[model samples]
Target chain A: MTAPVDVSLIVIVVVITALVFDFTNGFHDTANAMATSIATGALRPKVAVLIAGVLNVVGAFLSVEVARTISSGLVDEARISPVVIFAGLIGAIIWNLLTWLLGLPSSSSHALFGGLIGATVVAAGLGAVHFGAVLSKVILPAIVSPVLAGIIALTATYLAYRTTARADSGTVTKGFKAGQIGSASMVALAHGTSDAQKTMGIITLTLITAGVLSPDSGPPFWVILSAGLAIGLGTYLGGWRIIRTLGKRVSEIETPQGFAAEASTTAVILTSSHLGLALSTTQVATGAIFGAGSGRRLAAVRWSVARQMVVAWILTLPAAAAVGAVAAWVASAGTVGIVLVAVVAIALAAGIYAVSRRRPVTADNVNDVGDDAAVAHEPAVPAR
Target chain B: MTIDWASLGLVSVVSLAAGVAVVVLVSFALVGLSARVRPRPGGAEDGAPTLSAGAGTAIAAVCLAAVVAIVGFGLYVIVS
Candidate 1:
């Protein structure tokens, strides 16, 4: 058995790391909610992110079901330790930063799950993970949700165009821009409820492992508030790199397509959250934008950019898992090992940040697609 | 463990239907409002059709209300 002081110290470290992961999750996914709105000029980038951030905080308070699932459903809490969760968070944080630097909106959800599962396997063996739950809850939904969202968005976009074809173009554009605001707001709220809970679950599980909370206990009030605030603050910072990719690189979205895509994403994400399916909002939004782009004209969609994003999605789980496994192996050696891993992770994050500063993507320049030759050449939007 | 196929199916159906329904409704609203200009009995002086503030306004309002109701239901799902 571990000494009380050691356990408490590790628990604090794990909790802090979990919040760091939550912060990354927020900025990584901000694009999912506001990209379309910003792309179509429905909302200014600064205002869009601010609204999303506020709604995210409110959305986090509305549900705890997803948090409960994370705390108990994915892994056998009895066999794992807080140190393993810490290593897993480190893995997730690294992957999120790497993907963000590349402007690839990969699945932060999958990264977290992979990190936890990988660390658990390294520390407690494969049996510690509930394979059935991972297959049914995680894997199946990941395969289905995006495809489902895509199809729905495609159909919706087609119908929108058909129904509005005879209407005055100026009026139609104005009306859909108004609709986009409401739909995108819903996506932000749904994102908060779904994504913020993952961090809460990890922290709750850590508390349980540290013997500070009972098994099967829900996330405490403080955990919920802190997780919500971390993600909210991150969202306000705005992940401009990914926002640019989803907003402009994938498609030259008109107001109607933006409205349709955002509405479809909100519908799919909220329903999945209610059913307790932890899905990637990035995948859903990307799929919806692709659907909207294709529904208008197959050739209009930038297949090249979409393909690159797909490749990133495929790599997220395994790449994060590999990192998590290595971190866990090092951390299990002792306290000194944990500190070493933390130092190395911090240095790597700093390095990535320094590299990003060279070609910084901020809200002011997020819509500048003219610099990207591959996207600029597309016929969708005329290069400025 | 068995996959909860029922819940999965339910989510798929509801999301698809709601997504299509909302966009279609919004489009119809825009159409109703935008199509309001009818050619005057005598051709307009500037060749621009005059707005007929009649059934079109009513139809647009109904469609817009339906959208609001759907959005409200979504909020209900989150809160409940």
Candidate 2:
């Protein structure tokens, strides 16, 4: 049999793929952080993205802990090769693109985990997964983080409006829109700090697996800059499909509600990041958005859209994991495996782009939610 | 096929990731709290003045610098 493929080339390819995944994550999730503010006229779209892009770059510079978690805590890196991780990232990239095209706010965190898990299990059996870490760090947080943040936001929004009940609606809207800029910016910063690092950790781990870096080494400067730039550029591109869904479909977010949601999101996300807990920014932001809507008197929170998002979140990990595992198995076969994986990735990317063209959601059409009053009265779908 | 460099690398990467996360979280807490507690000129009517384009850019700069240092140091530790 031919000798095992060149390890260095594999490492480099994986690293690049990881960055590509990171870039998609940036655009896919940027809507989670800024949709409400943009919807409420708090920040202009271009300005909002510029602000978010800058914060994401800064945030990437902020933390390595989450990166470490992805690199080491979730899976036994020793059992699997860097090539395995590369295959997993390919799975993640595919899932991310699929969700982005649908404008579904799924969990990128889960996607990554699923990808890693799939590859690892295929490479080294179920023993590769750190179940304890998965339970304590991933599952527990996934279940509670969003709900907890939601309740807090709901209460905060109610009190915010009640306290200022005497103020004119116009006055409150204008004012909160202003406050939203700051809070939204903070969330973006936190997003960058936490999410970018995940990719960095992955790249660093690849380096370690390839014996290019020590096991305990953090991600290098070039990795950090490249990841930061990739994510920042993605954020600038903006995921308008999700923006439409979140900003207009979930609820008709007023300025005050947007402010409250952003503020609550900033607080909860920042706290979780500090605790070194890997939380889904999508979940946290979604919870806060719904909570803000429900808190307002007469403001309708569409459980239908919320239900859809939740469903997507629950399925993200397993679905992506399955994809990753398949990719890993194929990639491990030999030269053909590598070629097959690359062809699949390219084909999948092109497919998603083609599908997205049918009902293109750009900044121009992003705000077209059709009669806010009518949508508010739409029937709710049961939460699954 | 080799020593458990993967395990060591994993641990080191985790610490580096966590350390940076903590710094960002703490910084955000401080900034968020300060914005809340500090007295403001126009109250909530005019929104927040400090969260401008310039402010966002500045925060990003700090974040980038911190990430570079943390990762760089972690790599050094692993290599040595």
* DockQ for all candidate structures vs. native: 0.62, 0.04
lDDT (0 to 1) per candidate: 0.89, 0.75
Q: Write the per-residue lDDT of candidate 1 for residues A1-384, one digit (tens) a residue.
A: 332464577888998899999999999999999998999999999999999999889889999979888888888989999989999999999999999999999999999998998899999999999999998988888889889889999999999999987667778899999999999999999999999999999998898888887888998888889999999999989999999999988888888999999999999998888888888888888899999888787777888888888899888888898999999999999999899999999999999999999999998999988888668666574321
> Candidate 2: deviation at residue B57, Å?
29
RMSD of each: 3.2, 9.7
- Estimate the overall C-alpha local distance difference test score of candidate 1: 0.89
| Local accuracy of candidate 2 as per-residue lDDT tens digits, A69-156 | 6677888878889768988898899999999998888888889888988988998899988887787678877887677667666766
Q: Give interface RMSD, every candidate, in order.
A: 2.4, 12.0
Tell me the number of clashing residue pairs for each predicted model: 0, 18
Interface RMSD of 1: 2.4
**Deviation in Å, model 2, residue B9 alpha carbon:** 30
- Scanning candidate 2 chain B in windows of ten residues, the lowest lDDT window is B25-34
Q: What's each prediction's TM-score?
A: 0.95, 0.80
In model 1 chain B, the worst 10-residue window by lDDT is B43-52
